[model samples]
Target: MGVTLTDSAAKHVANFLQKRGKGIGLRLGVRTSGCSGMAYKLEFVDEVNEDDLIFETSGVKVVVDAKSLPYLEGMELDFAREGLNEGFKFNNPNVKDQCGCGESFNV
Candidate 1:
């Protein structure tokens, strides 16, 4: 399966894009950094690349590069407001381990 966004996450992204005024969707990718050797990267997409993979949920698009698909496959993007903290949460089934600070993970 590909990446998907929860309703709240999609709403959050959609609102952000609406405010920004120009974006096709959101891009999800992986980067080699942090204590666990891999980290999640998210960005707004104004243009779709030729090799990009796009998944849609709740009317919002979740884009991923081919290279990042394996690690991010079957992941769920969630938005939550816990107390004063608000952010996107990645529920990745492929993640075998993650760092203590919760900034990074490894398959």
Candidate 2:
């Protein structure tokens, strides 16, 4: 399995890209930091690297570098709103634990 986006996430990303007018897609990755030892990184890509792996879902492009593919495979990105708060949520099957602040995870 590869990366996927929820309908809400796809819509949100598409709208943002429309306003920005330059992005080719969204890039997802992981970095070594945070309390749980790893944290998610998200960015809009204007260009994709030749080695990048690309996945498409719900009309949105999800790009991941080869190095990050193992960590992010099978992940579902979602847009969520909870009362006064709203943001992107990651449903990562590889994750084994998450920090209390919800900013990082261990796999």
Candidate 3:
């Protein structure tokens, strides 16, 4: 399985890249922190690493490092707007539970 991006997510990323004019793609990963033990990380990548895995959806490149691939496989990223709030949401199948504050998860 591979990472995926919802149409809304892809468009959101593409728009940001276009406005910034320097990123090759978006990078996704997890870090050891937060109340639930793990938290998602997102960044703009100017270059791809040797062990990086790339998945494309709706013409946007979603890159992940090899170490993060297992945990992130089959995940879908989405962008949403809820009243006055808007942000990227992760639909991770590997997640077993999330913390009450919604900033992190446990797999």
Candidate 4:
């Protein structure tokens, strides 16, 4: 399994890319930080890297570096609006525990 994006997520990304007019896709990765020791990082990719694993979902490419694949595999990204708050949400199966603020996780 690999990373995926919900319809809402794909649409949101596509709209952003269109306005920015220079991105190849979205990049997902991990970093060593946060209380749970791991945090998710997302960025707009202008080019693909040789070691990156690319997953296409709903016509949008989600790129992950080789090192982050193990942790991000099978994850589904979603865009949601709840009352006054709205943003991307990660549904990660590999996560075992998450911090109170929901910004980091342990696997």
Clash counts per candidate, in order, are 0, 0, 0, 0
State the displacement of the C-alpha of residue 57, model 1, in Å, after optimal TM-score superposition. 0.5
Q: For each candidate in the order shown, give its overall lDDT on alpha carbons.
A: 0.96, 0.94, 0.95, 0.96
lDDT of 1: 0.96
Q: Summing lDDT over every window of 10 consecutive residues in candidate 4, give the lowest-scoring window.
A: 53-62
Q: Write the residue-wise lDDT of candidate 3 on 51-76 in tens digits.
A: 99999999999999999988899999
- In angstroms, give how far residue 73 of model 4 lies from its true place: 0.8
Worst 10 residues of 1 by lDDT: 46-55
User: What's the TM for model 2?
Assistant: 0.97
Across residues 1-107, which tens digit of lDDT does each residue of candidate 4 receive?
A: 99999999999999999999989899999999899999999999999999999999889999999999999989999999999999999999999999999999989
> Candidates' TM-scores?
0.98, 0.97, 0.97, 0.98
RMSD of 3: 0.6
Instruction: List runs of model 3 lying over 4 Å from the truth.
Output: none
Task: For model 1, give the RMSD to the true fold.
Answer: 0.5
Better of 1 and 2 by lDDT: 1
Clashing pairs in 4: none
